[model samples]
Target: MDFNLGTCFYILANYKGYRMSVEECEIELRDYDGEFLRRDVKTEGSIQPEHEVRENCKGCKRKIKLMDEGCVFGCCRVCCSGITKKISSFIGGKVRCCDVHNDRIIKKPTKSVKKPIKKEYVKRICIYKSLSQIIYTGHGADELLAGYGRHRTAYLKGGYKEVTKVLKNEVGRLWERNLGRDDRCISSGGKEARFIFLEDGFVEFIQSLDVTFIADFELGQGVGDKRILRRYAEELGLKECGNLVKRAMQFGSRIGKVVGGEKGDEEFEKSEKFKPPTTDPTKYDKDYRFDITLPDWLPYLQTHGYCVISSAVSSQNTNLALKSLITSLKLLHGNDVDTWDIPEHGLISETLGQSSGAWLIRGSSIVKSAFERIWEEKDLIVSMDCVIIWLSWLNNSNFKPRSEGLHLDQNPFNKLDMISVQGMIPLIDVTEEIGGLQIIPGSHVGVLKEEFKDMHGDMRGKGDWCQAKEEYVEGRGGEARLVECKAGDLILWDSRTVHGGKVGSLGGRREGVEDGEIARASVTVAMVPRAWASEEVLEERKEGFRIGATFNHSPHETGTSTGTVKGKLYEDYIPIELTAEQRELL
Candidate 1:
C-alpha cells in the first residue's frame, strides 16, 4: 500500500511509544483510530463501564433498540416499526411491555389491575460508549476482507468489475446504509461513534488492493477463496473470528428474531395482498410501494401518473374541512336517511359543492405546493368544482352492482394537452372500509390514450361519463391499485389517468366506525394554470362564486369557447369575495 506523508505521520504517531516493529505497526494501525485505545473491553451485559442502564424493554427485559419505542415497549415488529398496535386497551396505559405480551394481556382482559401504579420518571445523564469503540475490529476486518454476502454474490456472478462496483457503492453510501442508522441508534443511548474503517489511509489501502485477490472466491496464486485476512489470522494464531461468515449484529444477537425477522416472500405477499393492478414503471418488486418520505417522487410521478404526498396537509385543515362538511350535511339532510339518496347513476350534482368551508382545501399550502410541482409554476388556478362527501350508504343504494368508477377525468376530444391536474384530500383517515379513490397506473401513456380519444364524444355527453371498459383495464397488463390515503395526505393524479371512486370498502371495518356509519369523506380540487383561464371562464367563476354553485371542474366546452352555462347555477346565489390567489385561479 502506498502511504502518503499524512498516513505515515498517523502511523508513526500511533505506534511511536510502543516502539513496535513494522509488521506489528501494520497489523495494529489497520484497525486502530485515534478514538480507541490499543485494547479491547472485556465487560459484558447491556451496560458497560461508562454506559448506564436507562431502562430495559418490558417485553424481553433487554435494552431497547429504538429510543422512540417508549418504556412500555411492544416487542412485535409492528410496534417496533411504529405501525398500529394489535391491542386496543393497552394504548394509553403506562405499563411498558412487548406487543406479544400486550396482546395477551388485552385478550384476557378478565384480570384488570386495580392497584394504583407507582412509577418514577427520572432525568439521568448517561454517557454510552460508541459502537466504533466497542466493535472496531469487526467493522475493519469486514471492509478489508470479502465478508459481506453481497460482496461474495457479486464476485461469484460478475467477478471483479461487479465486486468493485459493490465496494464503491458501499463506501459512497456507507453513511446512508450503515453509519446513519448506527449513529442514530447509538446516539439514542447517548453515545457517538468513531469509525476506524473511515480513516483516510486505511480506506485508501483497502480500495487499492487487487480486486481478484480480495473478492474472487477461487483458490488462487494470490490467496484462498474467502477471507484473505484469515491467512493473517492464522499467522497471528487468532482463529476464532478468522473464517466466520458475516452476520449483522442485530441478527447475531437474535434481536431481529425476537421480533419478526426481515420479511420473507410469504410475508411480502401477505402485505401486498391489496396492491392493485398497475403497470410497473420502475419495475419495483410487487411489495415495493413508493414511500412518501423518499425523494424519488418526480420520477415516480412521471412513470406512474399518480403519487401520494403523505402528511402533506395539516390535521388542522383536515379537522376544519370535516367539521364544515358535517355541519353542511346536517343543514341539508337533518338526520334524514331518506333525503340522503343520490341519482340512480350514483352521481350527485352539487354535493357539498359550494360551502365556504370548501375553501380550506383549495387554499392548502401543501396542495398548492403539489400543484406547483405538477404544472412547474406558482401561477396556477384552483377549479371551483366537486369537493365530494361520498356517503357509501347513499351512493351504494342506486349504483349498479359490481360497477367500479374506473374512468379518466379528462375528456379526450376536448383538448390533446393535459389542461388540469386533480387533488384528493381526505378529511378523515380513508380506511379500506371507507372505500375511496383507486387508479390504474401508467394507463395514461401511449396506446391507452389513443384508445380513449375514440370515445371522447360519447364520454362527454350530458354529465360526461367516462368509464374504463373491462377489455381495456382488465385485459391490459396493469393493475388497479386501491389508493388508501390518511387524513391530511394529498393525492395527485394526471387528468388522463384511469381512476375512479371505489364502490365498497376495500377491506375491514374502520376503527370506531359503527355499522352503516359515514364511509368516505374527501374533498376534490382541480388545478389549472392561470394562463389557461379565458374571459368567459372568469365570468362564470364569478357568477358561480356569487350563487354558491357547483362550478365545472374544468373549463366547459361550448362550441369553440370555454365558459360556464347559465342554467347550471343554483337559484339562491350568495356572492362570496375571492382572495387574490382565488381570483387568479378563475
Candidate 2:
C-alpha cells in the first residue's frame, strides 16, 4: 500500500462522521504519494526519464519523474492531478455503508454489504475505533432493466441443434461475464452492485425487443432462458445501456481474475464429479460411510443414530442403518426432501412418522405426492438427492415404505437429531447447480439478529428469490450469486444459507409414455450434530478456503427445490474433456 498524494488522510472515526487532522495528513501524504510513485532499480547506475514516471512500472520505463527509488508500498506513479484529491477525500471522510462495494480505487479489497447510508443520513461523528466504511456503485441500468437477447436469437440460429448449443453456452458465460465488472462497478461509489441470471445456456446472438431476452416458463424452450428477468429489470426502472453484450469482468477491481483467468479448456460440470451409471457411488467408499462426502468432525457418517457410536460399530453397521432408514421412509431417510410440503415441515412427521406427516405425507408415499406437488410449480427448485432418488424410484412408484426408522432424537425412537433426520435444516450440496450453491458473501456478518429480516440480512436490499417466495425475496432486496467449483469438491455452507436450482435439462414421460413430465434434477444433504464437525470437515476435505464468506439464511418462507433425474450418467453426458492420464488409465 503506497499512497500517492501531497496530503495523506488520517481517518479518526468519531460520532460526528470521520475526522482528520492537517498535520496528520501532511505526514501521511508522503507515504500515500510514495504508493503512487514508481522507482528505478540499479546495480551500477542508470538515468531514467522525468515525466516518464507517469505510467505504472511494468519493467523499466523511459520516464521516471515520480520517484527513482521505490517506496515501501508498491506504488504506480500515476500523476493524474485530482485523482489524489479524490483518493484523499475518500480516505479522509467518514463513509456510511452502502448496498455496493466502495473499495474499487482503494488499496484494500472492499467487501459488499446490505445497503448504503446516504451522506445526509450519516452521523456527523463516529468513535475512534470505527473503521472507514466501504461502498459500491449501484447495479446501474441493469439493476432496474434487463437486456437478454430477445426474439432476435431465434432468427439467427438456423435450427434446434444450433440454438440448443448457444443456450447451453449462455449459463457458462456468467462466470466470466460478471467476474471483475460487478465488484468494480459498484464499489467505485462505495456502493454494491449485484444481479442474477438463470439461463438454459447463453443467449444474445438474439437481440430481441418488443420481444424479451429470457424466455418465461410457459414458453418452454424459450422460457428456460432469462428473458423474463430483462422484462423485470425494465419494470423496476433500469434502462438498457446500449447493445449490452456481456462485458468482461476483469476490467475492474476483482483481484481473483488477476490471480486467475478463465481456463476455458476445462469443463465446470466435471468438477461436480458426477458418477457413471450402474456405479454404486458407495462402492468407492473405502474410508467414508455415506454416499456423500464426509465432514471433519466425523470421517464416516457412521450411524450412531445416537450421538455416540459404540467403538465396535463397523462399516457394515452404518450400511445396515442406512438401509434400514431407507426402509422406513424411502425418500426421507435418504436425507432428501422430495417436494414442497406447503407448511413444508409436515413431511418430517410423514417421513419419521414425526409430527410433520400431516403436512407432507400425501398418501401411501410422500415421494409420489412430492412429484405431484412439484408438477404444480411454474418454477422448479432442485438439489442432488432429488436427482438420485428420482432415478432410484423412477421405475417403482409401488415401493412405498411402511415407516422411517425411529427419529434418533426419540430413543427406541431417540435415534438422530430430529432436524438432521428430517433434513429441516439447510445442508449444502454444490451439485444443485453446476455453479455450486449461491451465497451473499459476508452477508451474515455485521448484522444484528433484530435487524436481519430473513435468515440473512440482505446487503443490497434488492430481491428475495433465493429465500422467500418471489414476492418476499424481491420485496427484501435478497440477492444470489453462483460459486463455481470442481467435481468431487466439497463445499460447506451455513445451514441457513439460501440457494435455488439451475435447470440443466428436462423430460420424463409419465409411464414410458414419451414426454409428459418435466423434472428438475439436483442433489441434497442434511446437517447433523458434532460441534467439531462444520469447521473440521471443511479444512480436511478442501485444498484451501479461497474466500471467507459469511452467508445469509432465512428460515421462514424458505422452501426446498424439486428433484428429477435422467438415466444418463453425469460423467458421460456433460461436455467435459477429461485429462490425458485419466484416459490412458481407463
- What TM-score fits each model? 0.46, 0.20
Q: Pick the candidate with the highest lDDT.
A: 1
Candidate 1: worst-modelled 10 consecutive residues by lDDT: 118-127
Clash count, candidate 1: 10
Q: Can you tell me which runs of candidate 2 are displaced by over 4 Å? A: 1-51, 54-87, 90-586
CA RMSD of all predictions: 27.6, 24.0
lDDT of 2 by residue, 65-135 (tens): 44323311112223211223333454564332211112223443222211221111111111123245542
In the range 1-586, model 1's lDDT, one tens digit per residue, is 1112222222222211213344543343232221121112242211122223335433334455564242222223223222112121223323223323333333221222222122221111111222342333234445455566456446544666887787777677666755655554444444345677678897787788887666544321122334556666777987765555455554443223322344334345447566657655524233223333244665666677777776555676677877887676676667653475433323233536656567776766456656665677667767666555555453334332233458765656554466656677777776556567777776666666676655444555433336666666655425666677678777777777777766554433456654344555677776766667777766766666666666555633221223222223446656555565445555
* lDDT value, residue 255 of candidate 2: 18
What overall lDDT, based on C-alpha atoms, would model 1 receive against the true structure? Answer: 0.51
